[model samples]
Target chain A: MNYSIALKTLVVKEVYRFVRIWPQTLLPPAITTALYFLIFGKLIGGRIGDIHGVTYIDYIVPGVILMSVISHSYSNVVSSFYSTKFQRNIEELLVAPIPNVVILLGYVSGGIIRGLLVGLVVALISLLFTPIVIHNLAITLSVALMTATLFSLAGFINAVLAESFDDISIIPNFVLTPLSYLGGVFYAVDMLPPLWQTISLGNPILYMINAFRFGLTGVTDVDIKLAYLMTGGFIATLTLFSLWLLYKGIGIKN
Target chain B: MKALSIRNLRKTYHNGFEALKGIDLDVEEGDFFALLGPNGAGKSTAIGIISSLVTASSGKVSIFGHDIKADNAKAKSCLGLVPQEVNFNQFETVKGIVYNQAGYYGLPRKLALQRTELCLKQMDLWDKRDTVSRRLSGGMKRRVMIARAMVHAPKLLILDEPTAGVDIEIRRAMWEMMKTVNQQGTTIILTTHYLEEAESLCRNIAIIDQGHIVENTDMASLLARLHIDHFVLDLADPLDSLPVIDGYQLEWVSDKVLNVAVPKEIGLNRLFAQLSARNINVVSLKNKSNRLEQLFLDLIDTKAKGAHA
Candidate 1:
């Protein structure tokens, strides 16, 4: 197989699909991030003093950016893949000479691109409200990319198992949204009660948020090594799981 | 070399229904073959398995001598399929759809673009290339699929009812295109409800019924197997009574219409001459049905009777 041509074609198609619908895929994240900063930063941060040696708005920047990455990355894959299945165009790939891994990579790369684009937009919006700082550029970029990859794989799994359009949205709405909020986005985990703080540790999103926060603000509640470990582990797990589902032809071939 | 080879191809759906019961078949390279069957006769299942859309319980399929399971990529690269239903993205432009299909086959950008243009032109869809596929007429949409399938230029092309809803003119045009492709040395397997299509295009055929092949032979031989041909003749002058014909069985429908079952060995010219001798002026004559349709029904009916027995 001409892997180069195949991969490039799929990536171009994927990028074209999202870029063609910028209002739906790109605009909403920027608007939502602006509102979050206005309501949570200016209105609420006025009374609350600095918790981590920075304004509350500044403190929430990394978390907000990562939150956008997580959801967009996940939604991009789930909706795109599920729609392909629903529309029956997935046969194009299935019938092609390319390996299944190429198909998986194409979709994952698309999700990552959309996720990071939205994250970049949200970060730019955050810069308008508060002067952004990056204590460690390497960790910040690594965590952002890794987080996007992890969620994209999760979304791929969701798409494969989804029987209907409703099935695709159920996970993001019920599981992803709550986890993002409770993952220490609006508040520091240390501020929570001891029991809730331990429970917060259980949320995978918390580690990603804190890791990203550590990279940007140089402040984190969890150990940075453990954050990378947990995030890396989840990515590996989901990658294998997603590939397995594809190899087994689950929810695809009959 | 055979363009396609199947051995003991069998499939049992998850619902516990056996669709294919260990059928074996083969098609030589560059042959235009027809696979005819009633609905639920496992034709779709067999096509699905060969196309990799459905898993077979136990079987082996090879394309151009490459095993589908062991050398799937190579086998698939040698094959193109136009499924019974419209499967491309409706939102995509016709050019985008065909170009991307070429890309999927690993054709480089320049080559993909060139081939996409050639295929669209071949299918007479170049003017509508920029238009979204869903807005096209049904016949045009079918043409788009044919263009897409041909973009990759696979050695073997499988068309499942490619002209099901197409108008007669467009359908005949498609048949010409298919003939051109076949004449260019591309093997084609066509399954259509229109037996006339099979008779007109296919050099060889296989009629399947109840998960078994009832007839597999060359078109000439299959038609030859039907010993008798029935015709309904309209007379220019109303007949008082049916004329006595020696070799043909005649039935009187009305003063103007007569039905005759003539033996295949006896030519139609002899029957016309005999009627002329009897002072019966036959103005027009039409077959009860196409010869192939009659033979197809007889095969299916005979298979059903044998199964019952």
Candidate 2:
């Protein structure tokens, strides 16, 4: 496999696919995130001033940005990949001499790009509701990258196992949405009771949102070190599992 | 080296359905080969396995001496398979689709562009290069598939029912293009329900039935097995019934059209003499069906009966 050319080509195709439908792929996130900032950051935060010694709006901005990354990243890979399987166009890559790693990374890169783009849009939208400030630029960007990659890999796994379009939506709707909302995107885990706090630790997205929040406000209820480690761990595990599935040709091959 | 070699290939689906039962096949380099089989006869499975779209259970396939499993990259690099269905992204432009396939095959940007141009031109799709594939007619979609398969210039190309929905004019044009490509030293394997296509284009053939190769031989040799010939005789005048003649089975297709099945041993001259003695002047006499169709039907029928036995 000439991994260079094959990977690049796949990346270009994936990018083209989403970019060609920008109204659907890129616009919805901006509008939805802007609405969140307007309602939660303005109206609600005006009533409740500071959260953990910081303005309520600033405290939630990082969480909102991270949330967008997670949603867009997962949706990009799930819908695009599931569509490929549904249409049977995956055979184009299957028959090629490209390695499974190249194919995986190609699709993952597409998701990452979309997630990052949507995350950027949401961040810009947040600025309209509050003054923008980055406490640690490195932590913020790294957390964003790690979260996007993790969710994209999750989406890929979901797409692989999906037999029908309905199967694709079940996880995002039932599992992903609930997990993200409870993951401290709007409030800190410290606000919950001891038992609920412990359960929040198990949610996994809590670590992600906390990690991004710490990068933005330097105030994360969870230990930032453990947050980074957990994100890295989930990413490594999902990456290995995805490669194994592709190698086995489990669901992709009959 | 053979263009393609399958050694005792077998595929038993998870539900205990054995789709391919240890079939062995070999196609010579640069030879136009036809793998003919009815629906569910495992033609698609065989192609799927060779293209690595489906896994083989117990045997090996080699392309031009490259083992498909051990030397997968090399083997796949030498082969292209156009599946039975249209599988390209329907929303993609025709040019983008072809270029992407070439890039996946590891062609550099420059080379991929050149090959894309040439293939689209050969398929007469140059004018529709910018059109989204789904907007084109069914025949055009099939042509786009052919061009996509040709992008990397693989040593061998396998087309599964490539002309299934194509009209006669486009199908003939496709045949001409394939013949020209074959002459340029690219081995081709074609599968179609149209027996006339196999008889006219392929030099060698293998007929699979019920997961087995019931007949595998050169085109001429296979045709030779059809010792019975059928003719459609047009009568000079309408007749209510046809007279019985020994050594011939006559069927009345219509008042003026009669289907005559004559054995090779009886000869056409003998049939003409029989008709002449009866004062029945024949307006026109044509072969009822192509010879390969007859042989294919016989082979499949025999295989079915054997399975039942």
Candidate 3:
């Protein structure tokens, strides 16, 4: 199979879908990230001096960046795939001789691009409030990519389950937003009460945010190695689940 | 060789609504076959099953002897489908959509581009290659869809209502292009409401109604079985009493025109003899009803009454 060309074309199409509507895809996240910095980092940081060794502004940057990545990647796949279903264009791909794995990868790759691009924009904007430092660029980059892939797969699952536009928003509004907020985007799990801290451990986004936090500051609320292992594990699990969904022709067929 | 073979095909949706029921069909290589059905008939469901867009509840479909369930890749590689709706990446250019479709079938970039150009030029869409699909007119967009479907040049091409919303001019052009494609050894299956198109283009036809094949035969035989004919007689003078024609039925539509129906075994000579004997002067005559419209309506109406009973 000419997988290389297929992958390239799929990736380019994926990127162009969101990029063509930058105001809808990119600007909203940037604006939201800026507000988080202004209200949470500057206004609230004045009262809370230091949660860890670093100032509150520097500490929350990684979490905010990771949050943006997760949201952008997850939303990108869900919306793009759902739109294809809505427009009935997905029939073109379904009838083709291509393997399901290629379709999954192509769409996931698009989500990852949007996630990474938005994360970069958020990071640059965060730097205006405080100079951002990278303690381990490798760890930071790998975690970001892997986390985006994980969420992209999750989004694909959501899109498959979705029957309408309202179905698309339900997960992001009810599940994703609540999870990200409670996952330590603004406050470390250590600062939460014992019961709340125990509950936070079950949230996968907590691991992602803390791992990314470790990569940026060389300090972490959880073991950084455990963070890496958890992120990688989530990616593998989601990948297998997505492959099974594709093989069964889940929503595309029936 | 048979290009497609379907047996006992069935499809039921999640809500327990059965869309298809035991549809069996075969299209030989190099034949243009038309599937004619009403709006709610299972034409789309049958196409969906053959193209693998919808899973079957029961039964089997094979393309060139390759089973759709067991060896789907091989089966799909031999088939190309142009869906009823204009579904494509609207943000991409026409060239991009065609090339990407080729890539989905695992073709290299160079080969994809070459085939894209060929198909687009054949569809008269090469000039609009760089234009985004959303910007093209509906007819042009449908042409792009045809180009995308032909990118890989499959042996069997299934067009589901390809001219649903197209203009007469583009529709004719599309039909010509499809004829040329079929002439090149590709088996074509078309589902359309345009009975005239089927009459002109298809040699074999299957009339589907309520998920079953009500009539499947050669076009000539199907039309012959209906036993319908019409004749128009222009009388030399306005007549108060119509001439009683033999071996035919006649109705006076106007004072000067006599509508006539005759069996194939009888000729116009018998009708003329009867008219001449009655002192009915005939100035001109014409045959008006080799049409399929009345037959289709009668078939549907009969089926509906049978189901209600």
Among these predictions, the greatest TM-score belongs to 2
Each candidate structure's TM-score, on Cα atoms with residue i matched to residue i, is 0.96, 0.98, 0.91
Q: For each predicted model, how many residue pairs clash, with residues at least 3 apart or on different chains? A: 0, 0, 0
User: Over the stretch B94-152, how does candidate 1's per-residue lDDT look in tens digits?
Assistant: 99999999999999999999999999999999999999999999999899888988998
Please, what are the lDDT tens digits per residue for candidate 1 over residues A15-99?
8999998999999999999999998988887778797898888888899999999999999999999989998889888888888
DockQ of 3: 0.67
Q: What's the true lDDT of residue B274 in model 2?
A: 88
Q: Per-residue alpha-carbon lDDT of model 3 for B236-286, expressed as tens digits?
A: 889897666557888989988889887778877877787788888889877
Interface DockQ of each model: 0.82, 0.87, 0.67
Error of 3 at A75 (Å): 0.9
Give the clashing pairs for model 2: none
Tens digits of per-residue lDDT, candidate 2, B67-165, equal: 989999999999988888999999999999999999999999999999999999999999999999999999999999999999999999999999998
Off by over 4 Å in 2: none
